[model samples]
Target: MSQLLDVIVAEDNIVQSAYLARLIENLGYRALTVEDGKAALDLVQDSGAQILISDYQMPYLNGVELTQAIRDLDLDHYVHVILITGMDEDEIRSNALAAGADDFLPKGHNPTALKARLRAATRLVQHSKQLAEQHRILKEANDRINDDLNAAANAQRQLLPDIHTEVLGTQIASAFVPSAVVSGDMFGCFPLTDTLIGFYAVDVSGHGIHASLLSVAIGHLITPDFFARVVLKGQEQPAPANLARDLNARFSRSENDDYFTMFCGVLNSQTGRLDFCQAAYPSPVYIGPHGNAQTVGDGGFPIGMFPDLTYENDHMTFDKGGLLVLCSDAAHEAENTQNQAFGSERLEKVIKTSHRIETDGIPEKIVEALSVWRDRIPLEDDLTVVAFRRT
Candidate 1:
């Protein structure tokens, strides 16, 4: 029911202090009255007054001095100071305002004018306090949201595999850069045996946390137990072809209509036998040791697009020192500022001209080429690439 602020009235004259106190109380505010400027300053500091009404001439400290003392407290509380003055000099009024006084009340104002000034001051303080409170709440909420995002990003980073693994005489290297805090593109490798390695690169239909979560689900499914069942064919030994089919069937039955394009492969390091399959994904290029590049095709409709579609297994026997490069649509579909795509043809040219695939520079080259082609145009999709060499 109280709409008025906590006000401090500082006046050496008892009559003026009493008069202002009556006005303040009538206006529904609690006024703390002090006879001298020193006492007023002390009370304001102790009570945290939001408004100050002070006589211009007072013993010990004048209104200007009192205002300066209050400001020196340096508290967060906003104290709106009103100087009461009989002086008609413009210079005096300017000095009062420059000393941190918010307004001036002429000492001999009519009751109506005094009431009007107090009413206006009440509104101003209320509006300012409301704005300050809103700012505090907004800042707190923003901090909380930022903290949550950082926590989620750290968790996602932990989900990624450590980029080092060795099987037989084979060494693998991989890298991932999410377009956002998370991404839809995923890559992983698992050692199926001392001489065999299972690996996959997948790009789900969308991006962001939802797509990243789906990739996590796929990661969980790539375990030894799940792949064992997926690779199983009849009572006989499960082949790579059977693994591709089973994975597609499981994905079709369990997933939604939005398809995920992927290249899954199993490699036998001892014999240079690599059996792999693709589902509506880009064909992987085999870069032979002789510096020849050929696109290996194992095409099928992307899993989850068709329930009963069959995936074909493609086999490649690479010579020692050959390399394989697999990538997502982002690699080929990258566009320039003129809206021209950096198509698959450009990719092949880069690979061919380079003679030898520079182990460390492959990813950097792909990204650098794409960036140069973009020419400052914004990308609409995530770019991903993986390359491995058989030494």
Candidate 2:
């Protein structure tokens, strides 16, 4: 196809239309001449023609009428319309534009002015086409990412326990809510042996897919069988401190440098004694029969920071009728509409008020209180909470 024929010249006078066609050819574009606007519009529809050069007065449809018809045609490609007319009043130009003409030119075109206008029109057509292609590519990419996130979210949900359950001698209750499609927070409880129950919570360093994947990877790697592996190696079961250091050495990297903050604990079912380690995670809260909530452990460095860093284990007892709560940082960092951190203080208060509720309802109650304090504010981070009471 000749680049020149992308244009159609329409005029009621055959001589004028013929002259315009030749001028378009001289300008290096292929052109077609029609003696009226109606015929010119037909050519545009048939040829996917992009440019219309039509006189304001024609036997059938006039220039403005043709421009409006083209606009209403719903063609995939945009058409650029330039009206030619004897009138030069501002009102006429305004009406022509309102009628859908892209631009207007006085009849009997001067070579220099016509050349600049036509070239500019050509540039705009090309630019619009380019923008349309970019939009298409962007939509395709967005759809794929959304689909991937949906699948990842489902897999992440599968790695968690029921909303409430019992593990050995402890009544365990939990909640998990991701701020987005996937969460960086994870927690679990499993029987390490006939007398040992293991519990852990970790928040991988950030939100979304990368952090969620790392969090889930850690979850899968640590389990009841994991403790059994330590015994298979002919070594005593490691303390929570030893486990944290071991994980740090495995996950630490010089590039991208993925890491997490963690809390790990093992409960002796027979004695109701808890040995736990903290790695810069939020302190777990203890609520006993006295109806008060107190923090359990001192904070330490985050895991996977210094590969060889040593960790400290904290000791606590969860007698029957007592609640031990471990949560991701999101629990304390939740903000209210007043722009205040949900803070350790607020969490402690919530625990004390709800400690009298059933163990299974405690985490849910905290979530409900947080929802009210935010006053319609959306969660700004992934939220996870785990609590257990010796029965």
Best by TM-score: 2
Instruction: Estimate, for each residue in 1-391, the C-alpha lDDT of model 1 and write its tens digit.
Output: 3554678888877887888888888878888899888998888879877788888888999888888888888877678888887657677678877778888888774567667777877778788778989999999999997787678666655665555444565655555656676677777776776777777788888777777777767766777656655654352432555655666677677646555888887778878888777777798777788888899774766766667777777778866888777778887888787778888889877755543755545666667677788884545676667767676
Q: Which residue runs of candidate 1 sit more than 4 Å off their true CA positions?
A: 1-22, 30-152, 232-244, 253-257, 335-340, 349-358, 371-380
Per-structure clash totals for the candidates: 0, 3
User: What lDDT would candidate 1 get against the real structure?
Assistant: 0.74
lDDT of each: 0.74, 0.82
Per residue, candidate 2 scores C-alpha lDDT tens digits across 7-59 of 88888787887777777888888787788778988998998778888888887
- In candidate 1, the residue pairs with backbone N, CA or C atoms under 3 Å apart (3 or more residues apart, or in different chains) clash, namely none
TM-scores for every candidate against the unseen true structure:
0.68, 0.78
What TM-score, to 2 decimals, does candidate 1 have? 0.68
